[model samples]
Target: MQPAVVAHRGASAHAAEHTLAAYDLAIAQGADALECDVRLTRDGHLVCVHDRRVDRTTNAKGVVSTLSLAELSLLDYGGEIGVLTLDALLGLAADHGVPLFVETKHPVRYGGQVEARLVELLATRGLARPSTKEESPVVVMSFSTLAVRRVRALAPRLPTVLLLTQLWPTLRDGTLPPWADHTGPSVAMLRRDPEYVARAADHGHATYTWTVDDPADVELCAGIGVRWLATNAPAATRATLAR
Candidate 1:
């Protein structure tokens, strides 16, 4: 089977990352999944923004945790795109039938409140848990094992991914952390050790790699049986995988 092509922050290479327009273009480009980074606003709303601070991506300059949803709404993302709420993105996902990989940013001021609010919002949208015998439209991913565990407690059926930048003690044996359904590694890890993907599969974990854009990297992922390729240029990656 062909690996699933996930848009890393919604075709971010072609447009501003995490904006509505970028996500729209990703769906148009035939991305099998949409990847997003989410954080909690001071007012307890979940918004799609990558960094802890809004400085780099928006007109405003401050920590995202310091701003309320109302205050964040006043800023322009990429000069024209408004700040996106998790609700808005979920609506688009439902309308387009695209699966979403929602990465929870860690070490925020809100602590576990971020995961709690996220599970609540997903429940309200009828997505907190997968329908019987079906994969959920949404999967939660995080670098923090605690965060992934929190989601498992809140919604057991929702798949969780443990993101790794490098080989860790937990992964030296090729097993996923307890309660994690999948393993997400950097593309560089696969390059350094192509056997890592196969080892992850041997231990009953599906593997996904992030931020892959180069055609050679795409080929490497395909050859290693990566279940998902998360990339900034989903259209180009999709075409590459089809070859």
Candidate 2:
């Protein structure tokens, strides 16, 4: 079976990252899930933003952790896309009946507060925890082990993904951190060690790979049985997988 095609930052290749436009396009394109990076605003609200600084994706400049939700609202994130709160993004996911892969950015001043706020928000939508992962509409992912642990602690039944940029010594033995529900590796790392997926599976951890835009990489991940294939162009990736 083809891996689920998740739109990384919501079809970010066609629209600006973290914008409603991108997510809407992703939903329209039949993306299996929408992915986003969540950061805490100064007032403790969760916003969909990849970078700590707003200079790249927005017209104005400020640190996301330093700005209030209202302060962020003034900026032009993209044409008609505007600033998107995790609340609004969640609504979009609910409306479209698609799942989400929410990544909490680490090393922020808010620290565990990021994960806390994420769990709180999920709880508000009755998504904090499900009886089983198959019933979950969202899954939390992070490169920080602490962040994943916090999520697991706050919501034990909530699914968590531990993202990998490099091979940690322990992972060489094919076991993920005890707290991680799944493993998310960068496409480059997966290319270097495709066998890690099988190894990880041997230990019962599913694999999710990010930023896979190339057709060859898509095929590679699909052929290797990646559970989720994150891409900037979900439509193209899905089409490639279809072929």
What's the CA error at residue 68 for candidate 2, in Å? 0.7
Best by lDDT: 2
**lDDT of model 1 at position 68:** 92
Q: Write one digit per residue (lDDT tens) for candidate 2, span 66-127.
A: 99999998889876545799999999999989999999998999899999889999999999
Candidate 1, superposed: residue stretches over 4 Å from native: 132-134
Q: Name the lDDT value of residue 206 in candidate 2.
A: 88
**What tens digits encode model 1's per-residue C-alpha lDDT throughout 76-191?**
88855568998999999989998899999998998899999999999998899787414799989999989999999999999889999998876877898778989999999999
Q: Which ten residues in a row have the lowest lDDT in candidate 2?
A: 74-83
